[model samples]
Target chain A: MARVIRTIGWTLIVLGVVVLLYVVYLLWFTGFETQREQRDLADEWSLTVPDDPIDHDREVDREAPEEDDEPVDVGDAYAALWFERDGEPIVSDDVIYVVEGVDLPTLRRGPGHYPESDRPGGEGNFAIAGHRTTYGAPFWSLDVLEPGDTIHVIDRQGREWVYAYVEQRIVQPTELWVVGEDPLGSGAPMITLTTCHPRYSDAQRLIAWGELLDDPIESTAEGGERDEIPES
Target chain B: MADNDAPNGDDPGPRADPDGGGRGGIPRWVKAILLLVVIAVAVVVLFTTVFPWVEERTQDPTMGTMLTPWLAYLRF
Candidate 1:
């Protein structure tokens, strides 16, 4: 009986240690690793790109649906986000910094852009997702985001597009429409960010939607190019 | 019946085993083989069952598509 009790006790101890390590990895270690990845991406983006404008005007090609096109590959990053903090108290850093594409590997790096969502500087809803309570918990303070907080997405050409947080709502994990809605009919440019809700629980989704502060203007196709990135 | 066979009616030794076959328990080599077989089956199941499921989920960048909800139950 004592042997059996000892075995069960040891198993529990091992399990407890494993859980603690996992939390540590999710909270601290993963954040540190992602910081390294972001720095590498920043370095890569600063180099190996040239100045050539790429046209993105959808008006000229009305017959073809531009919105349905796939987002950039998981490997290629387009923008790094910088949140304005002094103007807002909720921001943990000046940069809540996220790389392009919200795939698992990409998200492990930082907040990921939902490729199906509208691109930055577009007429429809542009969406991004981040981990709410783990793996750096980029959006852990999402509950703190309210009206007036600014989320910035920098274009490949060094032009920064700004969006202002309007409101945030908590919805169940089953609430899929928030990310699927088409705002093109409204003729307003919007940005939506979704993360796990209630912190440490996946029972809900915390969605913070924002409208573009910058007026959508004609692009010279520069946002698509691999070059022309400013180091600063 | 085996309890009556103990030398001094004190230490039951191998006879105390429930099976009463004089085989106290599974042999050490048999236990090792069982462990190896269990590990091999687990690896096979993971590759054949879990690996593909994960691949399909990651193809889309959306949050719903990326999450393996069942795996989130432990939150560990």
Candidate 2:
């Protein structure tokens, strides 16, 4: 009886160790191969076969004009809102814009700060954080954004990427599930905008979800692109 | 006639019972095998279904920014 018990115990221990090692491998290595492949693809696509590259900085400095009614470009039209101690625009070249009417504070982040684990120029969700009621009330109207509203994000290239509103919900603060990668399942990409609820209380979080509705419009392509653009 | 006076005291009763057979307990080896099978199934399910779903949800922003290029890549 003692011999039988000892053999069984030893076998179980070995099996458990093997199972654990396999799980670790899946989480840390093999599971991440897809992302690496995607990154490689991106790098390959970004390679430019220069047609007629010129000094962009020198050209801009030479062409500066005074008393212009319209923006110099579409990129300039999408401005980042910065707060002041006494109500003034905080001007900086690094600031990025949030979706119009997203209740600014919820999406507000410090200039040039991006999360390390996330992709810098991805299409699915580009979430920014800001205060709900205070700090200039950026996201005050966040709860009021209905379906079909357009949220625009302008990248450094002066291209505008538009995302259309889909849904919104209020959930408990501890429900980290909302922030998790698999809110629904794989292949269903979405954006989740979140803020503290009830204006000033941290009781709950309000989330507004949206989906990319159109491809990004490069600054040079806007004039001709409008005709081919679909209603998103 | 003499042997039938009383039954032998050493005779055993039925070996198997509906609720409590003496040998019905699962051996430790069987239990270990079962545990291994359950764990393997769980890991397979998580990797194939659960993990991908979670990755999609949490990586949305990253995915969204890259979606255009990714879609174009797929076309080729």
Candidate 3:
């Protein structure tokens, strides 16, 4: 009887240890995979996006999609997402490439854009989903983001859309309204970032909302040859 | 019966263990610890290697995929 009890106890201990190791993998090892994917995606983005300097005098119709705003294939990287704090880059040289789909596999590579949502700087909500605790954990500090913080997105044509943080909401996972076309109900150009809430749990979602600012810097394409354009 | 010849008494010397001396005459507690260590190593391999290989095939990035039906609830 004593031996049987000891065996049972050891079995439980082994199970506990397994759970701990999985948590470790989720928190640490998974980031390596995401970082590698992001590096490749970043390289592709740099090569594809024009290097032309910001054309300050160019006119941009915020409500209309540009001719170059071709739909990005799902799982493919097309734009670079950057966070700014105090007018400086937040993640320090890390430019997270935003993939075209919010599916699990695409998100594992980096932040994913919701297919039904509007494009960056478009007249509706441009929603994105990202991981908070695994697979690069790009939104790991999302909950701490305060209003007025800025998020910048650079597209293939070198158009930079700047968005200012507005509010945050913790909602049930079933709350699909957060990603709706007019989440703010004003038909304004906005951004919504969704991630698992409360760290280490997916019971709910944490949403960070932002509105597109008017100062969009446009970089012109020079002869469609990236090599000919000088990098600033 | 042979019981009368051997005499039933508390003789703590080396005796035949029907459960098999696979225990190698080691103490029960020591064996239990060794068993736990082996299990821990297996668990590490399963998480660090086996599960990853399975994930690669399934293209399922979440760990919940391994647990399946039971862990389907763990998905976002």
**Which stretch of 10 consecutive residues in model 3 chain B shows the poorest summed lDDT?**
B57-66
How much does each candidate deviate from the true structure in C-alpha RMSD? 10.8, 18.6, 11.3
* TM-score (0 to 1) of chain B for each candidate: 0.48, 0.50, 0.49
Q: What is the alpha-carbon interface RMSD for each candidate?
A: 6.8, 15.9, 8.2
By DockQ, who's the top model here?
3
Candidate 3 at residue B28, lDDT?
45
Q: Rate the local accuracy (lDDT) of all candidates.
A: 0.58, 0.39, 0.68
**DockQ class, candidate 2:** incorrect
Model 2 lDDT at residue A9? 77
Candidate 1: which stretches are off by over 4 Å?
A1-20, A48-71, A85-90, A181-186, A215-232, B1-76
Q: Which segments of model 2 are wrong by more than 4 Å? A: A1-124, A182-186, A215-232, B1-76
The numbered model that scores best in TM-score is 3
Per-chain TM-score of chain A in candidate 1 equals: 0.73
**In candidate 2, what fraction of native interface contacts survive?**
0.00
Question: Candidate 2, residues A123-158: lDDT per residue as tens digits?
Answer: 334454434543233454566554435444433332
For residues A1-232, could you state the per-residue lDDT of candidate 3 as single tens digits? 5556866787778777877777677678989999999888877776776774233234443544467688789988866787766655554246678898877768888988888888888778888888887888888777655554677876667777787777777765656788888887866788998877667766557787888888743322122222221111
TM-score of chain A of each: 0.73, 0.43, 0.79
Instruction: For model 3, state the Cα shift of residue A181 in Å.
Output: 0.7
